[model samples]
Target chain A: MPEITYREAIRHALAEELERDENVVVIGEEVAEYDGAYKVTEGLWKRFGDKRIVDTPISEAAFIGMGVGASMLGLRPVMELMFWSFATVAWDQIINNAGFVRYMSGGLINCPIVIRGPANGGTGVGATHSHTPENMLANIPGLKVVCPATAYDAKGLLKTAIRDNDPVMFLESTLLYGNLGEVPTEEYLIPLGVADVKREGTDITLIAHGGAVLTALKAAELLAAEHDISAEVVDLRSIRPLDEETILKSVRKTHRAVLIEENKPFCGVGAQISSMLMQKAFDDLDAPVLRISAIDAPAIYSPHLEAKQLPRPTDVIAKVLSIC
Target chain B: MPLLMDTAVTTPNFDTAPINQSLTSEDKLRFLRDMMRIRRFEQGALQQYSQGKIGGFLHVYIGQESVAVGTVSLMGANDHVITAYRDHGHALAVGMNMNECMAELLGKATGCSKGKGGSMHFFAPDKNYWGGHGIVGGQTPLGLGLAYGIKYKGLTGAALCFMGDGATNQGAWYESLNLASLWDLPVVYIIENNQYSMGTSLDRSSAFRSCLAERAAGFAIDWDTCNGEDIYEVRAKTQIAIDRAHKQSRPTVLEIDTYRYYGHSVADAKHKVYRSEEEIERYKQNHDPIRLWKARLISEGVLAEGKYDEMDAAAKAEADESIKFAEASPWPSEASISEDVYFEVDRQTIAGRTGKHFFND
Candidate 1:
């Protein structure tokens, strides 16, 4: 087994799927000749040719709809939206058609498509390109939303998403692309709607997803080493079907829960999880659940403001320590 | 021989006749029967809506029956079709049984969409009918993409995407048109220009009200405008467009100038508030295509007047049967609510990360 960066893992998964399945194709603006905006699809066009790895014109609605249509016709199309913020331009196809078609069709049609792109803030990409829309997509009933934290999870989850017989919104982080982890070379898949306990402890349970999961893991290690506080870290890989059993069971053991997310503090995935915990596992708790989230402001272009907006490991550690 | 002489006398110009016209007497009867089936089926739906048996926005395509009938007749079994809310006619024309469509309107378990998708979301995958999308201009880009898929898969089939004249004003329509033309996708974009977009006439909503075909030239694709009232002309134009799209891998837009006799939906009064009653009467008298065709059949001795009566009776009986079936059908069960949300898959286990390094075992 070899260690690979998150970006390389994504590229490897795409390249391998292209090699394994002739029906798999990638389409997006600059995904072909320019090697993708995030370089996750580099060298795909050369190996698969222009037909498989297509560089579409800058028309998100048309290209995304084309991906949906391709999925209906038995083609596994992985379309890139470049930035999650740009997804609004194709919301009609994504929400009304892609998300609803299978349910509306009564299982007659399966939309086996993947809309992959970078989501949330870290770089000073500003308000336009920094908002995390995972909560909005998670609210939709018929869609599966996956946000992987590490390189290994990215490759495995993406491979599973491509093969899954439903439309999936696979969210990646701009900051985590360069982060490295050991990814298996052999074919593998990660089933969605499952949670992974990154680090186990008994003090408090910290639940997070995507980039925030990494921060929680770091904070868990720091808590164990410094204050002898054994904190449990849970990575919620799938957002829609939030793996409530794992979170509830972990909270029952620790009796204290802290949710970490990169989105704004108000009306985020944190709020939904907090409400679910209160309703289902309130009797098992020792302290009220606390949520660590970004400040209620748009991500600014300034580095200082951007840094202040995101949830850091120190913030997660403080939240856990406060609960403990 | 005597047989050849008899055949020559009764050839009926079948070669020169349009695709719909080239059909045998049985096929023509079947087409007319399907049109009547849709008409009667929608009438039942309207009654249901008024009585509260059905809910949601119900858009009926009554007078514009020829567009769906004429165009879908030229499409093969493997071809795909997508359309806007006013879609019952298109659904029935594409071989969806009247009973299933009626059951769908009643929100029953036996509906085409399993009672999940009401009238506006009708889907018959077995017939290759994609959907009855509720959004006005939403299907344009999707239709083009389906066409792209067909071409990408090296299939000879084409996708027939139906939209109204009002949808042409949508930005997605323009973007999809540009992409379809640029890629030379095998798709026939049919504009069911029914003169009004929910009481706003095309003259008021569209700047270029004369014809949508001229506007399509900007996309560098050839377009044609046909008299949607005349099923023959619609059939001919659609045949030409479908042929060009499949053979040349070029997209074509056929703007069919049609009319809606009823209000936009069951909610509004059927009376003409915007247009005059006299204008409606004039269209009914001068351009009633179904009546005109029936008259032509009788005058040319192709079909006896008795045959017309028999077909009408059969159509009425079919409509009555559909209503009975729909009324008796049961609603969907509550247990199956979340069944089709997503395709379920088995879970996978991951190797836990040790505290040693980012990659090493």
Candidate 2:
């Protein structure tokens, strides 16, 4: 076992996949030579060469579509969108081509493509660069959306995504990339649809993912120490194929559910979770599902507004307390 | 093994000889039939749109039939092809069933995209035809990637990426062109310079009004410009481009200067503010490809006037049958509303069970 940062874990996964699969290649702006804007692909170019590690121009639509086309032709293309917000430039290819091509072709084609990038509000990147699009992508049908909180999970899930048949949207938060966790040295893959119950309790179930997962876990610890509330935390690793079983099971046992998300409150991942719970587990619930999310306004450039716009540990704790 | 199968078999590549010397009577007839089929099919699409049987942006490739027919005629089944929104002609020319294409235009479940994608989004992966993309210059890098895959897999296949003069102005086009040339990918970038990017003419929109092949020179790609209206010329030039691409393992650009009879889409009048009626008449009179090919066939005594009439009638009838099939096809069922949305495991079963327990428990 080795203690590694989330960024290093991702870099290791890329290196391993490139080493193992001759068909795997990476294409993105500044991915090669520059070693990625976030350094998640640091030192990959030297290992793989320029052919496998491509440095593309600022052409998101072309490169993303290139990934889709390459995947269709049996190459595993791992593309990086420098920032999550830049994905909008190629939304048509991702939504229409990469997402729907396999089903459109009647299972004749499988797009084994991984579009990985940093997402969410952090470090005052401003409104243009900062966006949490878990809910937006979850609305799409053919994409598998994965958001890992810890270094170990990042490595395992990314490996799974690169090997998966369908396209995977691997969302990483800038804030969590430096956080350390014990990652196994051997090869391992975390399945896409499974959720990990980080901590179990009986009073309330706190559901979160990506950076918010860590916030939820911290909130759970504080709730236990201060309010004597035993809060259960479930990290929804994959947003699209949400581990409904884990969330609902925990909610049923705890009789209270609170969803913590960094996106806007309206139509966020929190809303989808709450709706699913109400529709299926309404009778089992002892309390209504509470959702903690950022305010409705666009993320401001001001550090104070940016901080206020994201869900904090205190926000998750307060929501869990109110519901319980 | 069978007599019928042997007769159906044909050479995989275009002949290296000159077009007239290389093509047999059968080859000429097949090319003529393909061109006629696309022409009639697009004409029917236009009629259907006017009648409101089809909706959305309907871009018909009328005069540019030879480009698709000639270029695709040179390719094999293993080769990959991608193109922009004016894709019906290319799809049909590349051997997609006319009935399925019509069904797609009608947004029927039996369509290529299962009714999810309309005219601007036809896809036939089994045929190695990637799609009909609506976004300009969107498929360039995709085509390059396909070529990369072909080379990476050590397959003797190439990818043909098609775009319009309008799309050439897009930044993605330049990026893909640069990458393709830099990597020496097995790709042929074909520019269908129909002289218009929607309403703007090449002279007005492009800085250089000469051949687009000159633009390819800057990227160090082997380039050629041909008269797109002439099926023979297009076939000859494309063969050279495709051959150079495969042999050299490098990218080539073929600038096919062609024209469009209809407006940009079904909605616009064939002629409006952009070009004068005189210029339209000049193109129609001087460079009518189908008519020129028909005359050449008749002059060569390969086809009689009556036989040409019969081919026209046959094409019209086929187009008619396609429309009927498309009209009679079923719409996608509401039950499949969530289908093809994602490639997720069937968690619905567990979700449903847990959902029921959540309320009851």
Candidate 3:
């Protein structure tokens, strides 16, 4: 086994997929000679050459739309947006073209593309740069949304996303890119729509995804250490497929649940999860499903204010304790 | 002043370019027949819209038939095409079956898009016709991407992106052009300057004083303009652009100054608020591509007298048969509502199981 950071996992996935599949190509701003803005695609440009690792201009709409069109023909294009907030410029291409091409073409065309980038508010990047859009992107019928919480999951899920025969929104976060986790030395794959129980306990269920999974794990540890309470942390790797069985099974054992995320509270991922728990396992709950998310406002630029804005382990602990 | 004038009245002679030397009588006849078929099919589409059989927006490509027919004729089978919503003519020109196109317009299951996409979104991947994009200027980058794929795959083909005059003003259009030029992607950005973007004319919409093709100069892409109403001119200019693209992996911006005889859509009738009926009549009588081509063919002895009447009758019959097929086609079933959403898995199954649990039941 080898321990790797989330950034290296992404690089490993891209390098592996590019080597394995002749049709796979990566296109984005700063992906080539610059080694990606976040360094997630470091050294790929030199290894794969210009054709496989394309360097695009600062035109998000053109490159994203090009990715969609390229995927339709034969090439599997992995388009990286510098920040997920920039996806707004190419909304029509993502929502109308990539999301509906196969359906509109009556299954005649499939847009096998992956649009990935950091999408969170951890770095105090302000409202324009930080946008956790897994909820919104997952709402699209034709799109599959994936957000990984660990290095092992990042490598596995990204590989699966590239191999998928449909458009996928691979949401990454700058906060988690440097975090290390143990992964197998040999090739491995973690299927999408599978939830992982980071820490299992019987008192309460802490539901989260992506970076929030760490917050939940820390909160669960605190609950066990400080209060003599046991808490189970569930990491939802895929937002669209939404492994309902694992979520229900966890909540059923714990009897109390608290949804956590770094996105805006209104219509966020937590809102959907709460609604699902209410409809699916209402009687099994000892208390109403609670939610802990970022404050319902645009992310502020000040580091202190931004820290207060996003959900933390303290917030998760408070929500869990209130429910329990 | 020319700025405020209806340029369709003073239609330039697009036949000035030396025609393809190898062009034969069969090629001329094929163009005539295809152009006539587009005309007849659109006329039938208008009829269906009026009769409440066809719904949503209907943009009839009645006057600009030569642009699509001529440009498509020059493209190889491997070449890709993408166009705006006024696209029935282009779809037919690119060899999409008339019945499937008509069925798509009628919202029937047998349509090229299986009724999921109506008039605004028709796609036939088999022919490399990417779509009937409804959003103005949305297909520009997609077309650019198709060219990128061609270059990436090392294919000896180009992607032709067709847009209306208004779409030239879109951010995506300019972005795509800049990237296409910078990358030397094999792409031809065709601007069908039909004089108007909906009710607004080019003078009112475009800030540029020069031709639309000059927009390509800003990106260092090669640029030219042609008489869109003339098939020979459009073919000659586009063939050169297409050839330069495949050989040099360069992009070209081509402006086809054509006209629309009718309103922008069924809702915007001709001469209602946009212009006068007399103005339209002037263009139709003088600048009709089909009429001009027929005359040239007849004078050149490629087409005999009375042959046009036979072609017209045949085109009308073919269009009527397509309409009948569309009328008899089935509607997409209820089970298909969530189908085709994802190629890797079933979207409907996920949707159906959203709140489904043993405890809930």
Candidate 4:
């Protein structure tokens, strides 16, 4: 058990997967000589050399579609996007080629490709650069979207995503990249479509994912120390194959729930979870499932306004207080 | 599969490539028969479409048969192919059974894509045929990846990625072409330039001089153009590009002069609005790949008298049988609609058993 940043955990997962399978190649822009766009793939090219680690021009569609194509031939491709917001440029390749080809081809093709990058809006990268697209990708049926909130989950989930025989849309956070957590020295893999309860409580359930999980955890701490309200934190590590049982189980016990996320409130991941809870756990709930999300608007470029634009511990606390 | 389907203007196409000389009369005749099969198969599909047997967009390769048949005939075991929605030509050329292809058009359980892909997406992995992709220029990058796989695995093979004249305008294709040259990938981008992309003519859509593939010059890739009607010309030019890919691991942009007799797809009933009746008739009566190839063989004294009739009858009969097979086939089960969405879910792997893949009914 060694402490490492989320960035290191991701690099270790990539290194392990590359070592495990020679067919796995790292493909992206600025990944080779430039370390990486965000230093996530730092030192990988130095270790793997030119053949294993490839750098493409600044064209997301070409490389993303190429990864989809290469994956069909049994070569597992792990493609990196500098920011998931740029995925819009390559929407046809990302959604149509990588996401739907498996179903379209009747399983004759399996896109064992991972398109991962930083996706969130707290850094004031503007609407062009900042996007929280977990729910957007999760809307597609064939894709497996994961937003690991911690170093441990990042390592375990990414390793599985590379090896998994389906197309995986791995969502990472620029804000959480440097956050420290304990990751094991031994090799470990986490299965997709599972949820983790980050902290145990009984009064209310604060449901969150990706960077918003940290906000939920902070809210849980404040609720316990200040308000004396015991709040449970459920981190949805995977978005598509949503772990409804884990989420419902926590809500069933707490009898109160609040959903939090950085994505816009309209048709957000929280929207889907709320609908699911109402249908499945209507009798067990004591309060309506409340949601705290980024204000429904484009990510503002102003740094001062962006802090308020994204989800915060205070927002999660207010939602919890209103519901519980 | 050059500038397009009707760029059939006579030009002295150089057949200097040694590869074309290796083709025996038997090989040339087989190519003729393959092209004829595609042509007749498209005719039969037209009949099905008229009768409401097939569903969705039906992009038949009626006139551009030689482009798919000629280029696919050049593939070795390691070589692969991927093309646009106008794909029945390549599907048959690569050895996909007519029953499966027709069933796919009918949306039956016995389809090549198991009734999922329909006309715009036909795939045969066992035959090294990746798919009949729908989106314009989307298959280009996938083609690069297949070439990437060849290079990564240290295999001496090339990926033949096919597109239309309109696909040349796509930003993805330029990006793919740039990477194809920069990476020295073994990929030959074959444009089955049928002049019109859907209802839009090449003049209105793509901006290029000489041919659509001439734009490949910007990427530093070698380029070639040839008549699609003559199997020998298509084979010779494509063979050189394939050789460049296999031997030097270099990419090539080959524009094959071909035509599509019907509209861009069966859905474009207003196809007559753009192109003239005389223009369409001239192509069918004179430059039709099947007719042109047949006349070339008869003049060469290689084809037996009435042998063309015999081959054409057999192709028509095979196509007719496909209709019967499609009619006899069943629709995919209601429960099976959820299947094949994920490999793990279909295979019932450990991960598949754990979660709710379909969240809503």
Best by lDDT: 4
For model 1, what fraction of the real interface contacts is kept?
A: 0.55
Per-residue alpha-carbon lDDT of candidate 4 for residues A1-324, written as tens digits (9 for 90 to 100): 799999999999999999999989998889988999889999999999999888888999898988889999999999999899999998999888888888888888888899999998888678998888888898888888999999999999999999889999999999999999999999999999899999999999999999999999998999999889999999999998889999999999999999999999989999999999999999999998899999888999897788998888888778777866
Minimal lDDT window, size 10, model 1 chain B = B352-361
What are the candidates' C-alpha RMSDs?
6.8, 6.6, 2.7, 1.6
- Give candidate 2 regions above 4 Å deviation: A30-36, A103-108, A286-288, A295-309, B1-20, B209-213, B269-279, B343-361
lDDT of 4 by residue, B250-341 (tens): 99999987778899888899889998999899889978888878887888888976898999999999999999999999999988788888
TM-score of chain B of each: 0.88, 0.89, 0.92, 0.96
* DockQ of each candidate relative to the true complex: 0.38, 0.37, 0.55, 0.83
User: What ranges in model 3 sit over 4 Å off?
Assistant: B1-19, B269-271, B346-361
Clashing residue pair totals per candidate (backbone < 3 A): 0, 10, 0, 8
True-structure lDDT of candidate 2: 0.82
Q: Could you tell me how far off, in angstroms, the CA of residue A88 lies in candidate 4 after the best superposition?
A: 0.7
Candidate 4: give the clashing pairs: B1-B191, B1-B192, B2-B256, B2-B257, B4-B193, B5-B194, B5-B258, B5-B259
Clashing pairs in 2: A141-B341, A141-B342, A142-B341, A142-B342, A280-B355, A281-B358, A281-B359, A283-B359, A284-B358, A284-B359
Q: Per-candidate TM-score, first chain only?
A: 0.97, 0.98, 0.99, 0.99
lDDT of 1 by residue, B1-361 (tens): 1111112223233235557545687666666666777777788778878889888778888878878988888888557899998989999988888888888888998888888989888888788899888888888888997898898998888899999989988888888888889888988899998777888877788876347767889999989877776666778888888888779989998988777778787776744897778867766675655665666556656678787778777777777788789889988999667567765521112211111001011
Cα shift from native, residue B258, model 2 (Å): 1.5
Q: Residue-wise lDDT of candidate 2 within A1-324, one digit each (tens)? A: 789999999999999999999889998989999998999899999888987999987878777877888888889999998988998988877887787766655444668899999998867878889888878887776787899999999999999889877788999988998999999888998877788999999898999999989889999899989999999999998886667888888988988898898888888888878988998789989888888887778888897677877888888877776766
Q: For model 4 chain A, give the 10-residue run with minimal summed lDDT.
A: A315-324
* Candidate 2 chain A TM-score vs. reference chain A: 0.98
| Model 3 chain A: worst 10 consecutive residues (lDDT sum) | A185-194
Q: Give the TM-score of candidate 2.
A: 0.89
Q: Which prediction has more favorable TM-score, 2 or 3?
A: 3
